[model samples]
Target chain A: MRKAIAASAAVIMLSIGAIAGAAEVKMVGTVQKIEMQGGAATVTLKDTKSGNEVKVTVKDDLTLDKFKDKRIVDGDEVRVKYDDGDGVVTIFRKTAGC
Target chain B: MTKILFTGLVAGAVMASAAFAKDHPGREYMEKNGYKGPETCEVCHPGKAKEFLSTVHWTHASKVDNVENTDPAREYGMKNRIYTMCNGNDIVNNLKEIPKTPDAKGTKFSGCNTCHPGNHLSDVGSAGPEAEAAIDCLVCHSREYDHSKRKPFKDDQGRVVLGQDRSVKAALAIAKPTVKNCMTCHEAAGGGVLVKRGFAFTKENDVHAAKGMVCVDCHKAKNHKIPTGFDPNNWAHDGVRVACADCHTETPHKDAEYNRHTARIACQTCHVTRTGGSFAKDFTTWEKLSNGYYEPTTLRKDANETVPVYAWYDKTVANRPDFIGPKGSRSDKASRIYPFKVFQGKGFFDRKTGELLAMDFAPPMSNGDTLAGVASAAKILGIKQYDPVPGWQTVLFGSNHLVTKKNALTCNNCHAPNGVLRFKDLGYSDDEVKRLTSPELYLQKMAEKQREEW
Candidate 1:
């Protein structure tokens, strides 16, 4: 229950952080874990370069459907651009496809 | 031609926006400056340029990592490792510096590095912005990149020079590399265009290419270092290796019988059914002609259909220069039945040292001195001067590409009597061969292994 609260707080920060930090950082990372709730989803990504787990919230409808359909599954390497301050991914897509 | 280049330019300009090309944030800056040099790209991507500067693609040599050379002293590429193609006498030794363009005579440019992406070969272990500035970024990033324009020649000043196409259009076209980008250099491998390595991974040859999969789909390059699996003879690099298991898991087949074969057989062994080349340059022998002109006698053995020689191989087979192949036995679990392209050429070899002497006979004769280059290489190898005997150098090239599921080998293809596979030569006993040829026995073994696992 405590873990769920932390995750919920993270999603709120993503919404508020979008306006705080506009400078998006692009990086390639492997998907470690995914947690979905209502219209919001949090993806745990292990950075390819630093090997650090970064929790980023995804609000995009297309990307959310990709997760639901298993098209973007765990262990998939994704090239993402996210707001470092809020932890919301602007661009999230698999690195393996054409 | 002008219209097409203009159309490509206009389209590329639209895509060059910072949002469109996230990787090339400075794409517009490069275009505005007419893509002056590798330095301009550093204005936005200093980190990317810095990461790529010291790579083998740029420096042509790096500290011994995956080289697997027998000589402990073979610590770097090109500088060490006596190459089978040119015997450490190609552009790696000849090219001293980069000039602006290929001279009128086109004498300064040599082979090997000709296929290399870099406009000039940087110093080994070199880093920093100065080295990064010398790198030609468009060659690997732009689909419109034309390698023919980047020619090397000797200027009247007697300095080696290179001609480059650094247009704003080319800069704007820059994006993440595609098959077209990699193939611009990789396609011209071996000898002139459409030779050995070039034949593989084409739209018609490989299934991946047919489905529009690029080299990176399998190669999986990070930063600048691409994973090369236990590089072939003369290929010196120390890095992670790409394996079939990376994509196809250890157990790829539905049936246990086929999956069991993966333990002893390579993915390419059955998939790469034949090697191709319309007029492939085969066995070449050099003759010191009576008129002091050296003549080369080349026999094109296989026109287009060439079967690869299956041999027991592991990653470390290329360290031994005398034996340029995968070194492993059938008994070794690390080894598998891998396909190979055997190269036979007449060259000088030392009988006492068993050192495959550098074949001075040149392709377009880079140095023009037949024995002079050989003698210098011999000195470096610490080979005592003696009567140089005429010897045949058998070099083996790995056949891992040009794959097709359609033409994959069936059981009868190798198991039938007088079959393509020579089981005895491959260290198989007569009884073992008989058992291997029997499909029932192979299935039984697979079932037994699966049962044991359960």
Candidate 2:
């Protein structure tokens, strides 16, 4: 019973660390296009929240499998999650190829 | 009728005068007709000719005629053909063979014209060394034409045209010998050039042999002049040292230091002795047992025991007892004294009464005449011969000991980029320059990668 309680506490700490490390970036716009090359994926995301458009690149390993095949184009509503690290990564509903 | 006949007579006289003008030898004939005879190009260029001749360019040229004294041909499929140059006074002593007719093909002699044309032999009224040299450049380097031996092809007119041997003709047409002149003959003629194969003329095949390197970079004549020399200490040869390590270093034995001692020993020293420019040797076969194969020979504890056995062998065998093979089934106890395994030292073989040999060495067990001992080692290990690998050697010699019988230079001694061939006379390419630069690094990298898997 004591070990189980300790394990739950460790999980709670890891979740809090992940949330602290992440920052919420809000951009609502139409999807432009998605593309993949050299193990990196680029998603053209237009801001529906800010009326801005930007293309973000993400490591191929970080993206979900369902998003892999989704076709993205201009003027389509979409949601995205991303990290700004060495380069930058933006996860989208669809990529440039889709 | 009388007037017409007079007019014809006048016309005929004018035609006769024109023919006379055309037939007569004039100032042009005097300028180009003949040689001043055998004058050394070195008088002006100093070391250029000697350096150039040492290159694969001059030494490895195909269609080299006027080499009257080569040894009897031994190569397979070339029966009665002349290969090596004959020794001694074959020309003076064998006078009966004099006034000899050439083989089926007309004789082709070596000269400046063999690679460089025009003033190389001289063309009528061709003036200035620059003019002569310029024409030579046009023939060889221009992609608009190819001087390589022609294969059959169709002309723009859709007529079949056979390519002639362009080596001689192209040089002749150019009217001068240029640095690029030698490439037509040097780059792609199989073993004729360097006694080495796998030379491709295009940039994709060999980026360097194509660029700047030419024949004179390595070879030298009676006098050494071309490459002033490179610096291991002083930093010469345009900043590159002209030595074997300049291009290659993978030695079969462990370590460069060990190889330095073993590599200098000629193939014939261990594997054979000179037998009229060839070795009188044999490769013996051994009997197969359940586990391995065995050959008949005495086992010697050391070099002292080997001497007596060799003495007896010299007296009994028709040929000298220089070559050894892994043979088996001895009738005499003395014959069985030195088994083949003893010669290879330890850990080179399996412990058995009889076993087939195999070879596991680089440069492969080819060149039967040169590396017979290495081949014997491979055969004993039951190793089948594989595609031969290319190799380079470094030769450090004692003052008295030179590399080759013809000249003191060894194979790698003069064949690399920084040798005498680097002088202006013999042109080598840039890619060869890069390849010849760091053979040691290449060996190191190969060993490192191999260790990863091992």
Worst 10 residues of 2 chain B by lDDT: B307-316
Looking at the true structure's interface, with contacts defined as alpha carbon pairs within 8 Å between chains A and B, what fraction does model 2 recover? Answer: 0.00
Steric collisions counted per model: 11, 74
Per-candidate TM equals 0.66, 0.21
In the range B258-280, model 1's lDDT, one tens digit per residue, is: 77889998888877777653222
lDDT of 1 by residue, A1-98 (tens): 99999999999999777767577888878888989977979999888778788999999764775576354777666768888877888768553211
Name the runs in model 1 displaced over 4 angstroms. Answer: A1-98, B1-27, B62-69, B76-79, B90-93, B96-108, B121-128, B155-157, B194-198, B277-304, B318-321, B359-369, B372-387, B439-454
Worst 10 residues of 1 chain A by lDDT: A89-98
Per-prediction CA RMSD (Å):
21.5, 28.9
lDDT of 2 by residue, B247-274 (tens): 2232433345434533333221222111
